[model samples]
Target: MKTHLYKMLLAAGIILFSISSCKKFGDTNIDPTRSSNMDPSVQLTTAQLRFSGDLNVNERTSFMMTMPLVQHIAGSYSNRWGGIYFNSPNVMGVLWEDSYGSDLVNIIDAVKRTTDVAAQSNLNAVCRIMKVYSFARMTDLYGDIPYSEAGLGIKAKFDTQAEIYDSFFRELTAASVQLNTARDAVKGDIFYNGDINAWKKFANSLHLRLAMRLVKINPTKAKTEAQLAFNAGVFTSNADICKTVHEDIQNPYEEVGKGNIKGNGVSASFFNGGAVPGRFTTPFLNQLNSTNDPRMKYMVKNYVDLPGGNPLNRIDITEPLLAVTGGYFGVNPGNYIWDDFKSAIAITVPGVGAYSALNNDQKAQPANFLLRFNAPFLHLTYAEVELLLAEATFRFGATFGGTASSHYQKGIEAAMLQLSLFPGGPTIPSTEINAFLQGNALIAGRELELINTQLWITLFLNGPEAYANWRRSGFPVLTPGTNAEEPGESLTIPRRFEYPYTEEEQNRVNFEKVLPALGGVDSWNGRVWWDKL
Candidate 1:
């Protein structure tokens, strides 16, 4: 009765979160808080938690679309939108809907409530940075969006991507300065627990990321902002990684998979049924195995899970071929859908156990993985910031700070070491890491490709960001999936997702205003402003 009652309560929580998440904010993001007494700290916590755990958004946007789109993982029906480059309307527009409707509504209101209040000043600054982050993610994927008048209860016209990028730099600059230890501590901050300095570092580090996106469009401005962020002190070590720490909850897969619980979305989405998780992509495995990357063993393994949503139903299994092959394998994107998934597992090779899936630690399989419910999901990391610094230094000059090669090494090393942040996560043997590093030292001529490829590898599970980086930096060049796919859409990987098809009908007047910039039509082929050809 106790267990049953607890599950019932959790189910109720998930349902509420799902229903509330779907609430429309009308023409633009109408302020969620009409009452004056509404607490901004509560709002901050709400936005942070929802942003991280909104499986509806993460699963569709990251897990389904971007992950497979980038060849990180594939082979399930869940991955087709991106894995095979199909143009699904809801899949393309879900991020826009959730951000404007719920996540943005809360954080925008939180900033309004806390702005200039002495006790809430630090909180306000954090909200400001988060606001930039939410909007940045929006623009990175769908460029030239409704920004200036959004959430103002007016018909919102699209803002050019250049204008949006300007706001990102400006807001990040102000927020980083506004964060001060002398001010009152922040409340409801999941990333840093009210630590003003950490938030400050995160803001500056994020500034570096957004700046790097401009390498193709405007190198001068990118150089300026990148150097400014480096001087302002971005994350210098693993301790400063900006990630969301989720609550350790009962039935995390059950609760979070349903979209209400405060748990890791990546984990929940990847292991939705806890029976068949998507396989590591063949291209991804090649990157690891070819280099004898030590992270391979930690990345994927064989597991045979009985048909159930409970992780406990999974049986530990291994592949004898791992030693010779140096890793387990995955099908090409879109090669194995629902029926193939069943057949593949049923007729597994004699020596290879069951099909390959993400390692036990990443999946959170009970005794095998206490890391599940509470594993910290990566947002921005020291690894990413260091790599950006490496890229910036390589592109511009030494003014951005350390030598590109040195930062490149630091970035790679940080990525290997930081996996331990996950409960029982990999502590890559230093000997192995050092060996990989020495063997793959930065070659002079191919600096750009090598640096961004490392960035691609480090950005394993965060699909949207990976997609953005790939578009902007053009690293680890991916080929379009060869599986039979939806015909009308671009056979090549899409450069950008079109605006929600509803925008054409519902907000036709305002929507049509941005069409000229979109080459007179709302299509993925029309590139974002920063995404220069």
Candidate 2:
């Protein structure tokens, strides 16, 4: 009941921010009903929800572009940009457009409004941490972006990824250190409910995440930050995972799915009641199917198109993989066309008769299966932190803590266990999880590939982060099983998305300066600064 009220209040706060956002800003523009000195709490709620809960950016940047680029999903009308390497500048630009247009504006205002006010110190500290979280995602997406001058509601110049990352480390360090639990708790903190300690841990964990990103470009700095974050403490358990709480607010308008703070944007990106947006690629499913993974039931199930063609019914059909294509969960990309896919998965069982399965388990999306509306947007997880620790310990050794194998086991368990947080989400039996862990131990030579492949699995819904990690650690070696002359495959996937299309016209001089770094063309083929490896 308290959670419900908070959602109502946060929704109201978002409405307030939206009013200011939708209106013109300047001396002449004023909202008399709204306070001249509105509470920074309002802006914080607005920023958090908009950043993690926005459907527009989730759909365009994550669902459409990054997910398929990393091949977690593929072969849908919406995924042409990433799936087949079709270039769509509009899709690539949505995160920049959405963030600058709304999310950044509010968060920046929150940071500025509370900056030297002693009473709002804890609030200010939290906002600073959020600022790093928000900006880190943006900078990671586009190599050099308008950071310092961003959110001033004007055309701003750009900053290199190096400058932006340096600021992230500084901000995270200060915010985690500045958090004072003795002070008054911050209101409207939907992530932690004003738990300053949790916020501290999250800051350090996030610091660790950003540090690992520096490995390819600057291993020395990476080692230093990882050790610093470790000594300061990171997430110790699932209770410490940094995530925003959400309500299963029925989206009144999903096709245009933004502005609803209570609905989960990541899930909404996959929510097409009348149609399946995409299918899990065979290479991805092989990661589970090849191992007889216990989580298979949680992630994959068969779908049948009934005789009446009554929009794909969910069923428990699991026996035809080896019978058809020598054991693969999904049809080959070569057979992605419907007619080809139909014959590939089509089979005649005695009791079941003749029926064709949908391309992948995600055809069950209309029923809110894996992509539940209330599922929390997992920003940072203990599982992810542990996995990173495992990799760091493997590379940099004891300074990062614990044996690589021990951390690897904890990470796998945590990843499987965390699924229970989803409403009606599947739960693997303890025996199964244990058996799977026992079967797969982190052996010496394959440590990097094994750790990173797990990272890819853990990053299911958060597409952009998965895409970035895939670029950083070339794991699980995705393939079309061909020479694969396309940009995104074995070693050289498309490195970055093109800059926002309007930047050429809106911020021309500054935009022109970055193009030379992109090899004289604003193409996705260009690598970002940290993509040096």
| Candidate 1 C-alpha lDDT tens digits along 1-533 | 33432343354344335435445444434444355676666666666766667777777888778888888887666777788777887888878876776667767778888887888888899999998988888988888888887777656778888998898899999999988799787755667878999999999999999999999999999999998999999999999998887655422433432445466776677666543566677788788778888877775655554433433445555443343344355666555534233222222346554544432212211222422656777899999998999989988999766899999999999999988888767788889999999999999899998988888889877888999999998888888886653442566888887788656666778788888887898777678888888
* TM-score for all models, in order of appearance: 0.88, 0.87
Query: Whose TM-score is greatest here?
Result: 1
lDDT of 2 by residue, 328-406 (tens): 4453332232413333366665567875654443232222345666778899999999999999999898776689999
With candidate 2 superimposed using the best TM-score fit, by how many Å does residue 109's alpha carbon deviate from the native?
Answer: 0.7
Q: Give lDDT per model, in order.
A: 0.74, 0.73
Off by over 4 Å in 1: 1-28, 249-259, 273-275, 305-313, 321-327, 337-371, 485-488
Assess candidate 1 and give its TM-score to the true structure.
0.88
